[model samples]
Target: MTTAPTPVPSSAAADRDSTRVGGGAGGSRTAPKNPLADRTAPRRRLRPAGGPWLATLPLLVFFAIAFGLPAIAIAIGAFTLSPDAPSGAGSFTTSNMTASVQGAYSTALLGSIKLSALTALIGVLVGLPLAQAVVTSRFRMMREAVLSASGVLANFGGVPLAFAFVATLGNAGELTKQFKLTSHGWSLYTFNGLTIVYLYFLIPLMILTITPALEGLRVQWREAASNNGATNWQYWRHVALPILLPSLLGGYVMLFGSAFAAYATAAAMVGASIPLIPLHIADALSGNVLVGQGNVALALSLDMIVVAAIVMAVYLPLQRRSARWLS
Candidate 1:
């Protein structure tokens, strides 16, 4: 070792030699390590992973133009006087809001709340058992038919169902003649009668909402509970109820919202006689005598806001509970 050990070529030099060997002698020397290549490396750059954002763009645009703009316009109108005033002199005012909150609107709002609460209660009572039956039944075809029918009925709200109820059970309805054999006859125009109609849709909604929760329950859990000598009631009360409670509450809130915001059904059943909040709002908008009719849009939007707030208030807690239960 007379001379200092020759410096060993680095791994970089080896890689260069390998590349040169791979290329022919006449081939251009491997382009001097592409400076931009490392920076623009495909493995390093984040890729745009497309998803629902792109898929739902049309829906987002439609909602923005149709609902969002109109809602804003209404909110602005609600804060200003002179319903017809377009531009000059009129500015933000709270008087209209005050009147809306304290006046006839208050009574209608209370009534709507009461009706919605009652409807939700009735729906839960009716739906839970139906869902349990559907889930536990041995007859597959019958269960499917029942579920399908409930789904159809749930969507069959508004005008057509109203007419069907009217024709079958209204004052001069066919059902009235059939029931002449018994002294107790039914009326479709009354509050209770409208409740019955609401329940028809409400029960189906409950069934649909509760079915998933019921199906989510494992047979093993039930069997294990039974093996531990738990009675049906005890098992349901201690285990099933806790698991199902959040979903049940969430379903009730949904039903309440549906019943509270209903106009067409109540309108068709009782017309102006019942004076539901939605009906009142509709009347205010359509009535020629009402000076602030144009402002009804604001009123309706406010009503919707209140309902939405109530639903969220009820739903948020249940959602948390549901998440915990699932976990």
Candidate 2:
């Protein structure tokens, strides 16, 4: 039987048959590539044309003039006699440095440390809860009011602040007279009074500082803790406190520095009666206690710089650590 010449498939039909066999049960046509499944190349950051130094030129210049020159002058002055020194006076000596830590100077330094530590510790204790409460409150108006008031109060220090406290709580003042507070041994010029004064501004400063960190605590963290059956106290102990420790410590350091460097309020309120580094430095510089002690004043300034440097060393790391999670 002459079967019709086996119909020879066309080239196109042969190709289609091959594709069907290769593609299996899905289909003969190739599938489209999914954009979501494709790995994307990472974006490169664009750098400034002039570089970082150029961008920071203004700040560098300002710092050099404002801080660098003064620091250099202080360093040189600390080790050298003042221009007002006598004809036979040597150019350089270690007596100023030696004298800064002696007797009353040492006592002043110790007093400053005690005051700063007290204020900072108290500020952290009081401000932490206030900050937490403000951050967690649903009332926008309350937050705004509190923050605005804090901003104002934090800046309200120096002579005016001393006057305010003096009027309200000073010996023979209105509160003292009305309530006989002085009879209870309350004195606005004492160390305890200064501690209270420092807290006035320091607490507000701590509030302003820690509010941001409190806000940075993720709601998801709390939710997760709750899902895992953690109580509020447990959540704070395990999660919140650990994360906030850096910020808390940083705030304490800031408060410490603020109280440490304070001059105007203490000068106004307590004068030479209270032994404080800033007041001592002022006394030495102004020659209120002795003439030609300018170099000693510079030495005291150097001592302060060293203490501030140590504080900054501790603070910078904590600040960076806090930023890592908060940012």
Candidate 3:
């Protein structure tokens, strides 16, 4: 005969057995229920996949109209013959591109490069320490004052800036006359003067650019360095500088582009005396010195575009790297 099955435990008896086993070491405790754990919780409505893209539509449209169309026009004009050409007017040619890098145009391109490089270098050298000082300081008012001033001064360029410099340091200005700066080899219309003017804005721009990077330096890094017997100089030389290199380089490139593309101030102050690419472009398009050089102007514009594209190529990567580290 089959053995009789053991009697099944009742639900109450099973619960009592579980409680006794679970409470052997300590009393059994009930877990508090979370109000949001069940179907009563509010669900977040799903957003359409295209909603974010639609918000960016206006910006895309603006860029296409303002930047894209002009760029396309410039590219087309750079290859097309000027109407005043002796023959083949409106026809496609590379002569404009060829001419853009020859003789005076080449010289102007070199000059612009030299000027931009010099100013960018100087801006980095000065601005890095200045930004560090501002970031490390404890004074809120001073920081705000400096940042506000920088924001205004960085945008203060072109005609009015040139005029301000002229009135203060020009040959006939009161300060220039009183100080005899003209006799002291201080001419406001020279290459050196342009550099000084460029620095006025470039230094401020550098401060603004590198401030966030400086602020990203965590206090714990310093503490870690200190605990590891690293001196302040050592910490900066090995740790901080390496982390900040990308941001610094990016700022330099930005300043280079700014100085490279500057037009109005150089035109108003130095005129054709200095062979800057921007001034040359203005002259070529305006026909002030040579008529029918529109294509040449367009070619110069293309050269600028190429330079800007290279800068962007270098900058975007550096910016991403900096953001990654800082974040």
List the global CA lDDT of all models: 0.80, 0.90, 0.91
Task: List runs of model 1 lying over 4 Å from the truth.
Answer: 1-46, 49-67, 85-89, 181-185
Candidate 1 vs candidate 3: the TM-score winner is 3
Judged by whole-model lDDT over C-alpha atoms, candidate 2 comes out at: 0.90
What would the TM-scores of all predictions be? 0.78, 0.83, 0.85
Candidates sorted on TM-score, descending: 3, 2, 1
Candidate 2 per-residue C-alpha lDDT over 54-156 given as tens digits, one digit per residue, 9 for 90 to 100: 9899999999999999999999889987666775464888878989999899999999999999999999999999999999999999999999999999999
Model 3 lDDT per residue over 1-327, tens place: 999999999999887665553454576655455777564544434455688789999999999999999999999999999999999999999999999999999999999999999999999999999999999889999999999899899999999999998988888887899989888898988889999999999999999999999999999999999999999999999889988999999999999999999999998888888999999998898898799999999999999899889878987887888788789
* Candidates 1 and 2 compared by TM-score, better number: 2
Instruction: Name the weakest run of 10 consecutive residues (lDDT summed) in model 3.
Output: 39-48
lDDT of 2 at 121: 97
Show the colliding residue pairs in model 3: none
Q: Give the TM-score of candidate 1.
A: 0.78
- Order the candidates by lDDT, highest first: 3, 2, 1
- RMSD values for the candidates in order, in angstroms, are 7.5, 8.4, 7.6
